[model samples]
Target: MTAHRFRSLLGGLALACAAALPAAAQNFPDRPIRLIVPFGPGGGTDLIARIVAERAGAALGQQMVVENRPGGGATVGIVALVQSRPDGYTLAVCPPICATAQSLYNPPPFNAERDLAPVTSPAELPLVLVVPRSLNVTDARGLLAAARVRQGGLSFASPGAGSSGHLAAEVFHRASGTQMVHVPYRSGAAALTDIVAGRVDFYFDTVASALAQIRAGEVVALGVTGTARVPQLPDVPTMGEAGVQGFDFPSPRLRVVAPAGTPAAILARLNAAFTTALADPALQARIQDAGGKAAGGTAEETRAELNEEAGRFGRLIREIGITAE
Candidate 1:
């Protein structure tokens, strides 16, 4: 072929590739996409994961299959998704647990900062400090004094290491200036159970996970782990508002992260689909009705929040002298 003809063909090929990007993105979900939930069914993580997966799947014209892989403090599911091909077929629907585990664990194969690209963090489910109704401590100040008086006598639990429970307790130690025995469990629901039974002195758990017990008065909400009082629980102040300047640990947030290196077009499409799906009034209502919050935003927004929290969690853990189990 003539040189001019060859150049024309190359230009046409580039144009074709560029033009096909949107359609290529739309062509995704040719098969069922796996929305891996790193927790057992019936927990808050499962509830939100299924809700978002179903709604987000509908928006994409593909079935979002939720697979529950509850182990290794939720690292099992997150690592699996990270290692999978980044064709946008495998996605992780997890919470802050993944980030916490990544930081607290002794050695993590998957680098959250590098391997898992943020898609979005739909909403934050702030963890609440709950004690048995019978516990003497009723607020952050009281809890701190109680910890001091107990003299390393109290015990606390998290679903596992690197979970909100573990990290929140770590922060409390800094504010209160004491350490509590750390108990590890496979699930937050399990830890909440022992707290209600008085087998454990206290637990910092997601509001959704501790809702039932808190309502039944089996546990009392001392304060939330945010900067302000949760609107839903107006009676409870945030850890900072409650006078613990260094004790702000939000609950396990539901985050959507795709494997790194997915096409930018595909990532944009997926991000749009997620934001649109979560913003729907009906979907938001459904989440609230189920006792959860729906948070949706741009990929960059989620990344910023995660980055901030990782630094905060890292510093708090080091100050408290807690190590990954």
Candidate 2:
């Protein structure tokens, strides 16, 4: 072929390749996506994951399969996600434990900031400080006073060491200057069982998980850990309002993340689907019913927030000397 003809052929091939690249990216998630929930089923995180997955999957024109992997302080599923192929097929809806994993575990199995690509945070739930009605503590101040005077200190229940509840308890200890014995349980249900029986003195549990018990009068809610009071418990006061000043606790959020090294195009696509899903009024209402607020933002926002949380939690964990049990 003539040189001119050859050059024309090369240009045609380049255009075809360029066209194919975008087509491939757009065709992403042609198959069902695997969504891992790092906690057990029926929990707030799992509920949020399932709801978000269903809606986002509908938007993506693909189904998302949610798998529960509950262990290792909610890091087992995260490790599985990080080890998966970074092809955007595998993702995980992780809790605060995702960011805290770095500080909570020694020689961490996976670096969240380094190994996971943030998609979008679907929902956020604040911790509620609940005690059995028999405790006779109507508010945080009362609870603190009671804790200070009680012998052996008041005991607090957490799902597990290094969990969000555990971290919140530690922060509360520092802010309130009251030492509480830590009693870690295999699951929140198990812990609540003891709390209801008045076996455990207190627990900082998710509003979703504790709402039923609170409504049933099995537990009395003293204060919410978040800056604002939750709608489900408008009568409840925030920790700060309850006289616990300087209590800076980050509410537990459900973040959608994929294995690091996933293509930016794929990440953007996933974010768009979730953002769309989170914006739906029906979906938002469902999230609210579950005791959480729908959170939707750009992928960059998610990454930045995760990084900040990692740094903050790492510093706090080190300062508090928290260790996994």
- TM-score for each predicted model, relative to the true structure: 0.88, 0.93
lDDT of 1: 0.78
Per-residue lDDT tens digits for candidate 2, residues 168-259, read: 88888887787789999989989999999999989999998998899999999999987898988999988988889888896778789999
Q: In lDDT terms, which candidate is top?
A: 2
User: What lDDT does candidate 2 reach at residue 159?
Assistant: 96
| Residue 254 local lDDT, model 2 | 79
State which candidate has the highest TM-score: 2
Where is model 1 more than 4 Å wrong at Cα? Answer: 1-19, 250-252
Q: Write the per-residue lDDT of candidate 1 for residues 168-279, one digit (tens) a residue.
A: 7877865676767888876787888888888888888877778777777788888887665665677888788888877655655778989988777777878888888988
List the candidate 2 regions with Cα displacement exceeding 4 Å: 1-20
Clashing pairs in 1: 122-295
lDDT of the candidates, in the order given: 0.78, 0.88
Report each candidate's C-alpha RMSD, comma-separated, in the order given: 3.1, 3.5
